[model samples]
Structure formats: C-alpha cells, structure tokens
Target: MSPMILIALILQICVTNVITGEYSEVVHNFKSIRKNVALSILVIDGDESNIDSSSLSSAEFVKVPNIEDLYIINILNSLDKNIFTSLHRLQHLKIEENELSYIGPAVWAGLDLEKLSLRNNQIEKLDNRAFDGLKASMIDLSNNKLRTLPNKCLQSLRLYKLTLANNQLEDIDLETFGPELAYADLSNNLLTSLDVEVFSGVYALLNLNLSGNKLTSIVAAPTLKKLKVLNYSHNQISVIAGNAFDSYNQLMELYLDHNQIFRLNHQSFPSIAPIKKFTIDHNYLTGLSDELLNALDNLAYLKFGGNPWSCKCLERVLEFIRSNKIGTDYCESKLIPQGHSCVNYYDKCYGNETKILSQNFEIYKNFIKHYEC
Candidate 1:
C-alpha cells in the first residue's frame, strides 16, 4: 500500500469507467435506430439535407413536402424501384395536393393495396386499367375533375365504401360499380340522367347520394329491394312513375326535395310489409289526391312544406287530414281565396267558418231542385 500501488489502481479504475460508458452509449444508439423503421426523403420544404433515400424501410410511411406541381411520374421515379418491387403487401398510400393526371395502366399492378386517398389532385380522367392490381375496399377520389367512369371500371373490387363526391361527372352508368358496392357518394355533380340498369344487380347497396344534380325523373327499379336510403335532392324531377318504387320494400328514407315536381301519384310508393318515410318538399304541387291519402297506411313521416299548393273545390284532402293522424304536420294556406275552405255547388256558399260539408241538408236539396227543374 505505497504511493506507486495507489496510483496504478486509480489509473485502472478511470480506464474501466471510460470503456463502460462507451459501450452503453453505443448499445443505446443501436436500439433506438432499430425500433423505428428508417425513413427517407422527409422533405420539410425540399431542403437538401432531409433527402436521404438510402436508409428507408420497406414498411414505413414517408411524408413528402408540399410540392404540388411535381407530377406522379417524377414522384414514382424518386423512390427506389426496389422499394415497391413487391406490390402485394402495400396497405396505405396517400398522395395529397399533387398535379397528377390520369392514372396510367399498370401503375398499381399486382398490388393488394387498400385504403387509398388521392385528394386535392387535378385528375381529369380515370383510366379503366388504373386499378388493375388493387383489391382495396375503401377509395376516396373526391375533389377531382373526372367526367365519367368507364363501364365496368370498378367491377372487380369488393369495396365497402366508395366516395366520388365533388366531381364533374354529368352522367353515371351504375354498371361501373361491382355488385359488392355497399355505400357510395355521388353528390355535388352534374348528373342529369342515371341509368336504371346501373342498379339492376346492386341488391346489397345500403346508402346512395345522387343529390345536387339535374335529374328530371326517376325510372324506379323493381329489383332494388335492399335499398335503405335514396337521395335525389336539387333536381328537375317533375313526375314520379306510378310503379317506380314497387320493389323497394326495405327503403327507410327517400329524399326528393328542391325539385320541379307537380304531382305525387297515389301509387308512387310501394306497399311494404313494414312502414317507410317519404320527403316531398319544395315542389309545384297543385293538390293532394284522395287516392294518395288511402295509399298511406304505414307512412311514418311525410313532409310537404315549401310548395305552391292550390286550394280549390277539390280540397277535400284537408278534411281527410283532420280525420286521421297524419305522419307530419299538414299545414293549410290561411291566405287562400277560399280561406282554407272549399265551396262547391252542392254545399252552401259560406264564406269561411264552414267546417262541415253540407252534403245532406238544404244545400243538397237546392242543388237537386236547380238541376231537376
């Protein structure tokens, strides 16, 4: 235990501490890198330092900077071709705010990619073979300039929801969607006429939005028995065929608002074993027929507001409304010429406050005497 022995022991202890510290630091750094799937080209604003394509992982999602002008061709070439070489395991891919035109053929070839979003792009056309190798279930192609979809373009996917709202499609042929299509959004378009055969075999469809279009009339399908919701708002529909809804027994909500309709026939809706709801607002209705009242056996909800309804001698439907429990509030025009009352020759010419129809009293006897004499 001299000075020389103590100095040698001190030197050994310092050297051992340095070695242990270096080993611990190296192990911690290695573990951190392994935990994360190494990313590539995380361009915050196209900064050159953030472009590192060599250390990318195959299973990682890499977000690019806001380079909307870069076309899809350059974006595809920037990635390592080997990264997307095996196209079967890709699950999610989003390319937001790009100037991508039509998706060419074989772009997604041999891929089982699901849940794709191509929002805020300038795509004008959707090539039919663009979705050749995808078996996706959910696809969002909203906010594009697509004019039409080719027949049978989407007849392969087992999709659960397909949204193509806010586009420029003027017409739609329902045959483009496969039979497995369950939900859809075709609203905010310029569609004038929809092919009835497009929904011929789509028995499993649950919800549909054809609102905000130019539909003049609907040729109802007798085979859409499983349809639950149908929206045809903001159109030019004037006449609804008598047997248009003969087969939609399971429909729960039907919207036909903000249109140019004049009459709602008694046989407009089908007689389902279960009840249904109907909306017929904002139209040019003249009167409600008596046959239409008898047809409403199980109508739970009905809205006929915001229309130009006429009040004439044939306004017996108002009396019918007071007799039964209407589905919705049946409002009468207080400013009509007859003041919510109908005057006929068989009844007395009473000016307002006449709630009862004089069918068996002096009014009937006077009408018979005038006609018989």
Candidate 2:
C-alpha cells in the first residue's frame, strides 16, 4: 500500500469515531441536568426537552406542554408523563393551556402547595381528596367547563383568592370558601341566587364580583366591613332592600346595571360616605326621588342613561343638567331632543299647560362643584 493511502485511511477512521460518540455524550449530559431536584415551586413553560435536574427533581411545577403554547395540540403526548413528579421542591402548581381534562390524585401525592391555577382548560369535575394537602394562597378555576365545584376541592385553601368565572356552575354553597379569602370572582356562571351566609366568615374580603348570573336580588352580608367593590350587573334584580348596603362602610363602587329596577326609595343605600362611584344604567326607571339618592353625598360618578325618563318629574333632573350639576351631556344625547327645557316640563301639555311644578334647581349648585356628571 502506498504511504499517502495509509494516512488517508487513518483520517477517515478518526472522523467516524467522533461522529458516533457525539450523540451519546449529549444524552449523558441531559440526564445529569435533572438529577436530585428539590424545590417547592416549578414553572415548566415548554415541551420537547430532556430535563434531568437533580436539585428540582421533587418540586411541584406548573407545567405547560410548551412555552410556545403549541406543543400539546401539535403532538399527542409526545413528552413523557413521568416528568410531572420529577421536581421534589414543588409545593404550588399551576398548569395552563395544556390538553389536560382530568388530573389524577396520585400525580401530586406528596406535594405541599398553597396555590394552584388551572385556568383556561376543560376540567369538568374535580375528584374528592384531589386537593387533599394544599394550603394555597389562591386558586383559579376560571374559564373551564366545570358544572359544580366540590366543597372539598376548596376546603384545603385556608385563605386565598378563589376565581371560578366563565364556567357552567349552577349551584354553589356560600360556605364552601375558606376563611382566609380576600377576593372572589364567581361571575359569568349559571348561579340563580347566592346564599347570604356565604360571606359571613370572610373578614378579609375586599372585592367580590357576581355579575352575569341568574340572581333575582342581592343578599349581601350584614358585616362585610372590608368590602370595597361589589359588581352585581346583568341579573334579574327587581328589588333592592334598604339595608342591603348597611354594613359596608368602606365600600367604594357599586354596579347595579342591566336589571329590572324601576324604583329606588329612601334609605335604599346605607349612607356610605366613602362611596365614590355608583352605576344604575339600563333599567326601567321612569322617575327618581331625591330621597333615593340623598345618602350618597360623596358620589362622584352616577351613570343613569338607558332608561325611560318621565318628563313630568324630570324637571328636577333637567334643571340640574342645565345648571351643570352632574356635568353629563345626558340631556343633549338625542335620546331626549327637545333640549333641557321641554324635558324639564314639556310633557304636561294639554290640560296643565300653565301649571309649572315647583322644582328647586338652585340648591344643585353645590352638587355641581363636586360631580362633573
């Protein structure tokens, strides 16, 4: 054999050996990355990766199929399911945007969690003891297909924000929430009515939203001292009790829009001096008495459009508009065209043409300075 041919053969063998050993070395390094993992929380934001972390092998993690949010639908369980329990330090878990319908209890057997978020999924039912040892700060089951929330599913959450919005919930016992709750959103559900005692023990509550439900009336707590914002929109409410807002001294905003309310009497609100905004639009109101709104002395915004106004009693409101009390252009909105004067009294045309009802619009000068309308 020639000397040049012998050198060429040796070079070819060296190149082949390097190519064969590259893939095996890469796999070995991947196994070392997931060794002895220990942590309380984990956020897995993608799929198709060999994670062999030693320090986080036992942690709880909020795992998604991929950070791109396209892995689960792209491949049918391409990743191994055993990766969920590889984290030893994981206590709180939040898995979102995955193709998960139901989670087995054994998948999270020895975790210590105080928060969990399973939003934007298709979970229909939660099993008993599925959340047995959780001490979470909050849990979000919103935007799911849940028909009923098992009382036990929330028992372990000693105190936290619980959101169950945009679901198929038809019934919920008020007492199902834990004592440490500071906020709750049960809106956009099939709930017909809420239990009054549901808020009895929650002292830290600051905001509550029950809008877009089937409630015919509101039955709020009598001692919700920390309450701030209460939204009860898009319901069948026709009646409002006078003492409904008695205990909420710190209340700020109240929404009662899109209901069947035709009247509000004196003492309907509990004289909340701290309240700044109140909305009562989209209803069947024909007239408003002064006594009904006298208690909201600090009111800044009062939305009252989208209702049939009686021209007879509207002289007071028209005069207020002309005097710029509420500062809103409601009278000029084309819904009431004859300008502010006709709506002030033009409806009493035929027999009572000369009779002008006594309405004092002068006192509203003080109200105009406070409210821009």
Candidate 3:
C-alpha cells in the first residue's frame, strides 16, 4: 500500500481503539494516535471531577496542525492558554457550562476562528485583547455574568450576529462594535438610557432588541436608517421625540407595549415606509389627534387598547379605526370598554356608554363635530 493509505489505515485503527475504551490512560491514548493525520474535530464532555488535568495537558493536541472545530463542555477548570495556540486553522469553538470566570488576552491569539460561543458560563470579565486574533462572524456571549464589555475587545472583528442578552450591561460605547454588524440583542439588561450616538456606525443593522430595560424616552437618532424590526417594550418610556423615527424608512415592526407614555408627538412617524405591525398597548395615553392618525396612513396593523381614551378623542380614534378597517370587528365591537373608558373631562361617558357611542361612527362624528372637549 502507498504511504498515504497506510497512514489513513493506522489512524482509523487508533480512532477505533480510542472509541472502544481500549486505552486506559488519556496520555497513552494521545501518544498512540497517529500524529501524521490531522485532527479535524474534537469534542470533550463529562464531569469535571473525573478528568485529569495533567493527562489533558500531556495529550499535546496543540501538536495537531489542522484542528478545525472544538467543543469543550462542563469542564470545571479555566481554559488552558495552550489549547488553541497551535490551532491556526480552527474555525468554530464552543465552550459552555464551564467554571470559567475570566478570559485573559492571548487566550485565542493564533487562530482564525469564525464562530465562537461562550454561553451559559460564569464569565465575569474579558481582557481588552482576549479576542485579538479571532475573525469571528458570529459571537454569542449570552446568559453570563458579564457586567461590562472590555474596551477594544470587539473593535476589529467582522461580526454579523452578536448577542449580549441576559447580562448586567448598563451602557455600551458606540465605537465598541464595528459598522458591519447586522443583528444585535441587548435585551434583559440594566440599561437606563441610550444616547443617539449608541448606533452611530452601525448602518447595516436590521434587528435590534432593547426590551426589559429602564429607559424613559425614545430619542431621535439618524444611524438607525436600515433597521427593520425594533423591540422597545417592557420599558419605563413616557416621552417620544417627534423625530424619533424620522429617517427610519425601512422599519416595519415596532413594539412599545407596557410603557408609561401618556402622549405622542404629532410628527412622531413622519415620512416612513408602511409599517406592518405597530403595537402601543398598555400605556397611559389619553387621546390620539387627527395629525397623528394622518401620519399613520401606511399602518397596516395596530394594537391601541389599554389606554384611558377620552370620549371626544375616542370618537375620532374610532372613526379612524372604522374608516381604515383596522380590526376584524371594528364596526360591531366596542373600541374602548372597561380598561379603556373615558376619563377626566369626559367622566360622564364611561363604561358601556362610551362603548355604545363608539360603535356608531357617522352619528358619533356628526355629534362630536359640534361638540367641544
């Protein structure tokens, strides 16, 4: 047989022996394997107590010249700096459910990694150059104890999907991430407010989630022009600047539910593309004016329930809802009933009385045309 075929046969036999548990010691197994064959995939998972760190260190996997994918799960020890030093061709690496608390610089210095996931770990800190040599396109560091991102940690990476959810991040610098990033999820954090410069260089971003935060206002920013979907729900937002979404012509879906917004600026949605889904339910809104209704001409779906609708303003909103066929039961259903009753100036028109008046738009329109708020 030729040398290449002979080497392949020997490597196959060694792998079979390793899988059948013939080798009693890990170091012996590593030493017995054919070193000429490249190790393309390696997965090590088990209880940390059973693994011998000395044997792992002696295995010399770094000697393999073409290791590509590596997954190490439930390992109790911190990541060894030498594990990936010689893996110049490594592409995907996942290390989950570990006891790792910190990642120092030069841990991944020599690999051309593409996808890296360190999810579900106790990682609390990252050095500035921890990700220095990696060219990862997708990085998921979710479900960790990270309180902050290190400066220049993500400065030069060409990332497409980055998820930092379920952390304690209170703020992030605009220049920390490169401009080519497309999808980012910063939800379930401790963010109190986001400045307009937070999205300054991210022009290709398509989806952004900022829910479950403590934000109070929705400020206008010009860098979110290409965003298609936004989730700003579950926040303490009470004010939205008129130009908050001025140049965001590509936004299609928006979620503003469960906020403290009592009013909206008339030009809040000036000159944007047709919105497919828009929800403002469960807020403190009291009325919707004609100017706001006209600006939402391209709105195809809406959720306006759970607001204290004034009787006079409720009639006009109901007329807009009826005219646009907003709901399946628009004409027959009571638009503002129970939780959405007339309050303050129109206190007498409450409960079923507001409901009955809202069901008839033509008469309600003529009745309200001469009426005053």
- lDDT by residue (74-193, candidate 3, tens digit) is 753466554577667778888777777788776776666778889888888988888887778889898888888887688688788898988888888666777888888888888998
- The C-alpha TM-scores of every prediction are 0.63, 0.66, 0.73
lDDT of 2 by residue, 1-373 (tens): 9999999999888666545542111222222322212222123433444433222232222332111111111111122323444333444556665555554454445444555677776778776555654445777889888888776467555756889999989988656777677888999999997788877777888888999998988875875788899999898787788777778889888888877676665575777547777777666555666655566666666666554455655555544433434433343333233454544333333123212211222332343333211
lDDT of each: 0.59, 0.59, 0.70
Cα-based RMSD of the predictions, in order? Answer: 15.9, 14.4, 9.4
lDDT of 1 by residue, 1-373 (tens): 9999999999998677646542111221111222212222121111223332222233332222111111121122122223333433446656545556576664555555556677666778877776776777778888888888877777777787788888899877767777777888898889888778877777678888888888888857766677788888888887788877777778788888777676677687766524456677666554566667666666666665555344441455444544554455424322223344443321233222222212212333332332210
Better of 2 and 3 by TM-score: 3
Q: Name the best candidate (by lDDT).
A: 3
On the 0 to 100 scale, the lDDT of residue 15 in model 3 is 85
Model 1: colliding residue pairs = 174-198
Can you tell me which runs of candidate 2 are displaced by over 4 Å?
Answer: 1-92, 103-115, 312-373
Error of 1 at 257 (Å): 0.6
